[model samples]
Target: MTSDKSFFDFISNGLPGPELRKDADNAILPARKLAFSRFRALGLPSVKTEEWRYTNIQRFLKDSFSLAQEEGTISAEQLKLTDIPQLDSYTAVLVNGRLQPALSKLPAEGKVTISKLSDAANNTQLQLWFDKHPHLQQQPFAALNAALFADGLFIEAGVNASLDKPLHIIHIYTTTGNAFIQPRHLMVLHKSATLEIIESSVGLNETAIAFVNSVTEIVLEENAELWHYNLQISEKNSRHIYHTSTVQKADSRYHHFNFTLPSAELTRNNLSVALTGSNTETNLHGLYLATDQQHVDNHTFVDHLVPNCNSNELYKGVLLDNSNGVFTGKIHVHQDAQKTNAFQQNNNLLMSEKASINSQPQLEIYADDVKCSHGFTVGRFSEESLFYLRSRGIGEEAAKTLLVNAFAFDITDQVHIPALQDFLSEKIRKYVSGAINN
Candidate 1:
């Protein structure tokens, strides 16, 4: 094993040189520099790192990926929003980490406020929020994002506001060769607010392997209700890594649904929910489909820090061909968290002998009075069901595809938006068709 010094030398001198900020550095630059120094001290996460054991970052380090330069160009019509569902509602478009105002369309009601992160100097409230959330400095990728991120979006819902239309944020990556893009977003829902948000990631160009490291933070105040949906559909040569954190207040309800389908290399997702007030509720659902030589990993943590909090999580995956999948979930009931109810479950379907899956569900209950349970299941398709489908004159391939789709329905059905549901269903069908043809 190489020493920490060796890793530092590798990143600072080896491969492509570290990118320097040429434009005017923001007020956060000094703090971000300190964060970079911290990242240097920590180095890349290896198998020795418990949180990164299943997903490796060594290969990513060796690759010559640099912060994207503002040289690429994309058109509004070329963004391919036509295929996306629920796009007629309020929408924001970002290409290669830069917000495209000309391509974006806002709702007519004007109840919501949207602006670029680069222009946040005038927003004192957002500035205060950033000051309070210095935890972003501890994250290596997030630190890098802070230092290099060019543009992002900030969304706020007024108190007692209810948005009839969902807000969709689209990030499109169209780099030619190997490139890296980091997009940051912060969302705030005030007291008694109700909002729906949809986030989608897409990549074009097959020759270059793109890396998208994104972070999003959501804050829900008292009695706020939020429904969030995330859809990731990158081409065969793209890698995606995401970190999403949520903070909920008293009587708040937050629900999240994530769908990951069709990526070429590796993808990792870290989702954390913190219940900071009493009577908070949270629900999480995820579906991942991997085929060929792809790899998908999900890590989730739920912290019940207050009394009378509730949380439930379900994650399912379908692994076919030589693909690999992993799920690790932990629910922590703090000492002060009395009357907490938490449940977690992970299920996987292996379609080929070479396919692999790893599942770990854990619960740490410091409060004896809390109710928490976790379970996992891993298996292949049911032979009895296959036989029944065959007896009904359905072709073997078609029957298998149908069963795979049915297995995915549990998570896909959770998407309440009609357009999004249709879009996701179509993508799943395409993946199933490809798996059958293979």
Candidate 2:
């Protein structure tokens, strides 16, 4: 059998030509070539890599997978078979990493601007926006994504505009069980603009095997407010590597809500947020559940570049069976960040003897007047709490469910959106019940 290294070889040797960039209007090819070179110079992470010590990603890699080189035909039937239940939000659909414009219903033209990457690439303003963001060459997966992404959603809200409903982005993969794809999304909110974004997925089973490298870039101008939520749930044989890079300006607010549920064979998420302006507030809350042999990892870094930027993070996870999970978070307070306030904590629950977690939370403070603290905990449910539930006539599974639900609430309840919160609650309950039943 071919080894995991073959996957890298396949991607590096298969870079496409200008036809792939025909609609991109030559705006992305240069970036794509640079990223491909970066990937070749610095290969995939190994066990020796400090950031990847906990997860053995090579075991999940394979050379048999094909790249989704062209748009896959999506039937009307496939459009209706979405994993996420319908919600009161604007919808944008992508099939096999290609935008399905006919199936997508965007907001009115003047209120906001939402278009496919190919169409948006022709806009001079969008090109300038891309030129101003941070470099993706530092992260191998991100570089690979940039090299391969053909199309994605580009959303920009005008200054002082407030979206009445959230924007829902649904990504569906279905070329072949053994094909890989990279999806990219870009969002920019002008000054005083407000919006909510929800990302969800679909179309996979245990027999499925695929690789997904995706990235989302965001920019928030002065006084803008953004609420982002991600629901990542995939099949047992699927591997997902996703990244989010965001920049916040002065007086802006950014809130993140994340839920990672069962059955993905491998999952890694990288989140980096830069507080470029003072008086910015950022909050991150997440819940992850892993069972069987699923492996999940979340790494977050917040850079406090200016004074008076406040950032807080709380992540909780439940691991059952032989599943493994990892959490590593860091908050940086620069010399000029005199009034920075940063706090980070990761709490995990191990439900089986073989279940394990590797958690590390770090704080780097250079300013004297900053308040920064970080910590982690890995433990089982409290015996007394479980006993009390059982004493109240609950069965073993029921008691465990009650306790797990309460533990997850510590992070889930912090989501202010009522409908989204309710949906997440039901999803978590179903995942917990499935784990106990298995």
Candidate 3:
């Protein structure tokens, strides 16, 4: 095997061409190219690189993949397969990272405004935000997305507009061949606006090894409220990587819940939240279950850049067979961020002896008046709980399943929508049943 440094260098040097770049108000060609150069300079992160020690992308870098550009259509029949419950509300559809107008159903009348990125009349807002936040240009995968993305969905909620229905965004990855798809999403909520966004990803082909690299940027104005959900269900041979970043203003509230089920080779998710104003609140909850030889990694960062901010994070995972799971979370409170309240916890359950989990929860508090705490735990099913259930007439397999479901209920129950909560419960039940049969 080639050394990690050499491998990253090889992949970085093979950056895609900029000839067929997408047309944006302010072309990101220069920024994207500069990011590629920075990526080459940094190379693949190793154990020495504190942020990447637990989740390694070296193997993925060594693989050969091509970026997809041409729009591949998915028939209405194929789109029907992704019918999400309670989807009568506003919805946006993207196939192979390109927005599908005919496939999407938008709310006829609502405070929410949804339109195709290519057709949106908010070029001024886009340019201003992108100019002020060039950090998006520096993100490796995000830069790749900006440079290659053809079109996506752009959503904006007017000031004080309280959406009565959730907005569902479905990303369908249909494999024409072995290729990589980068999907980009931008959501902005004006002051005092309330919005809920749901995202789901699905792969069509089982044998094709496709890469799904996605990026979502959210901006919340003062006193805005946002509830976000991300659900992943991809083919066994497909790989999915995601980066989600959020910036909140004073008194804004942001809540996120992420669910990752079985997938193919590997899946990594990076989520970050920056509280740039006072009295901001943020919460993150995640659940990941992987079986077979699959690997799943979840990394989160919360930066309290101002005073009187608060954050809470909880991530749990279950690994069966020879699967692997990882969770790394960091909460940072700046010196001026006094009175910040931050808490983080990661817990995992390993079913089989071969299953493994790596968890790290960290806190960096530069403010002496802050309250921050972090802890992690990794263990198998409690024998005592299992014995108690079995003694009450439950079968061995059923007892185990019950315990696992109970452990996952904490996060699943947080889904306020009754329909969504029930759907997720059924999914968890099926997953446990399959594990027991194996």
Report the number of the highest-TM-score candidate: 2
- What is the alpha-carbon lDDT for the whole of candidate 3? 0.77
Off by over 4 Å in 3: 1-27, 44-48, 86-88, 109-111, 120-122, 131-139
Each candidate structure's TM-score, on Cα atoms with residue i matched to residue i, is 0.91, 0.93, 0.91
Q: Considering every candidate listed, which one attains the maximal lDDT? A: 2
Question: Relative to the unseen true structure, what is the C-alpha lDDT of residue 372 in candidate 1, on a scale of 0 to 100?
Answer: 88
**Model 3 residue 72 CA deviation in Å:** 2.6
Give all candidates' CA lDDT scores. 0.77, 0.79, 0.77
Candidate 1 TM-score to native: 0.91
Residue 371 displacement (Å), model 3: 1.1
For model 3, residues 1-438, the per-residue Cα lDDT tens digits are 248555554445445555544442344546555655665555445556776676666566455665545477788787876776655556788888777768887776566777766555345555545423334544455655654555666778889987667878888887767777777777889899998888888777666567787878888999999999898877687788888888899999999999998765788888888888899999899999888888998988898999999899989898898899988897888899999999998889999999998887777889999888888888888899999999999998778767877888889888877777776777777777787797
lDDT of 1 by residue, 180-283 (tens): 77677777888989999888887775687777777777888999999998888878878888878788999999999888888657788878888998998899
